[model samples]
Target: MNPQIPDGLRELLALAAGAGQAPWRTLLRPGDWLLLLCCAALVAASYPLLWRGGVADRAIVKRDGRLVTELALNVARKYEVTGAIGTTVIEVQPGRARVLSDPGPRQYCVQQGWLSRANAVAICAPNHVTLQLAGRGGAHADYDTINY
Candidate 1:
């Protein structure tokens, strides 16, 4: 069905479209544009600080789906974990940890490199080993899923 506009409303629309009056000025005033620019600038400056992950204070190691050990991030050291397949070597330094060597054929976890931020994780699927970084309070409660 065709919808019809009332005649008075149609005439008002036509006049506002410059059909029978001077050309219209923009609806936005200078103050409106200034407010919009300020809001955009604030968001741009704050986005990175708020979204970047927290500082990691320790590394949690797991093997065969069980907790193996927790290494403090304040001291540099290397650890070995026995997993389903073979041994996986982990290295830890101030505020970071990474899989230094893994028996997994793909070596994906070793290639993951340093995990400095809270909630960072590396998994050696073939060896059944996992390394996770956490802050003093542990993993962020707000995140639903984190990918490394």
Candidate 2:
């Protein structure tokens, strides 16, 4: 007895065989070039806001279950948190933060590192602490805070 093949499978194989042809070159039209130029200009105009550290985003800090402070990020680095008696320095990095203090058994906050994106957060579940970033329009828009 001979094996039979499905018609759908045969059609797929034929399509794959036909797809092995050489790639084709594309020519950008004048309209396409104009669109590209416009996009580039817009990106260039927003570069300062997009790249400047801490100036475009807000930081929310919580300690001992209370809102301590909120500030704008001016640079990216390890943030050390102090002032909590009997506690160690809390280091914050991009996407994670860790506490060096052995306040308790869990050490969960030390496990979470720095957070980079706007509105993202890290929490010390053991200490009931949290650090969060502010999203667009959620941050204070005081003119004094803006860096020229």
Candidate 3:
């Protein structure tokens, strides 16, 4: 004997199997426009961060958890700092600073390239040297501290 299925359920299943997906416009509600606008606003709000990155005007060098030296930007100069292990060299320009040399085996800090924007940092764990940038508003550190 075969089991009997309800006629209404059978028709509904057949209709569902034959129908394709509905269009997105058909599924969208009027309130969804508010959500779309909010998303657009959020995207638009992030645009300024790109231009605000390079406004830093100070260079701070720290060694062995102590403030070694703090230099104001806008003038071109080079500064040398001694760490717990070895020596480090730092150079600053109008709006940027970078590590010229860091005594280390890996030379990772020396290879960090130019740091011309706010919050840029370079650290040499082998030599215990750090270079960081800041703005008048506050100091920005991507990595707070590293100990090796």
Candidate 4:
């Protein structure tokens, strides 16, 4: 049997054995560093645009396509909103809100759990109800990636 090293492996071995300077110093040029810095800056800039965690102070509850009422999240309370199908119990705590109960067959809104972030929404399509968290700007606050 005959054994032979591949051309790429042979070249790699030669480079590793003969190189005097450090591999990073030789591999990374000024332009490479500048590119890396630019990429890092782009990533840093995208954070604010992509991840929006606004301060939510209230929740806006809508039913049957009309504005029903606004509930303050700071004061914990439960409000029953009448929708097309039935009543939906909305529970609000400090900086958060959720659908405690819904008359819809599929409890998608109830299963959504707590919503504490601005622009976070829980929609009960069957009941035509929507519960959305809002900041001081109301529902006009900048939306997060999920909402956008």
Ranking 1 against 3 by lDDT, winner: 1
RMSD of 2: 10.3
**Mind giving the per-residue lDDT tens digits that candidate 3 earns over 40-102?**
999999997666645778888888768888888889999998876777889888887888987
Per-residue CA lDDT of candidate 4, range 56-118, in tens?
888889987788999988898999988888899999999899999999998999999999888
For model 1, what is the error of residue 107's alpha carbon versus the real structure, in angstroms, after optimal superposition?
0.6
Q: Which stretches of candidate 1 lie above 4 Å from their native place?
A: 1-53, 141-148
Give the TM-score of each candidate: 0.62, 0.40, 0.59, 0.61
Which residue ranges in model 3 land beyond 4 Å of their true spot? 1-50, 140-148
The lDDT for every candidate, in the order shown, is 0.84, 0.56, 0.78, 0.86
RMSD of each: 5.9, 10.3, 6.3, 5.8
Q: Which candidate leads in lDDT?
A: 4
How many pairs collide in each candidate, listed in order? 0, 12, 0, 0
lDDT of 4: 0.86
Better of 2 and 4 by TM-score: 4
- Report the Cα lDDT for candidate 3: 0.78
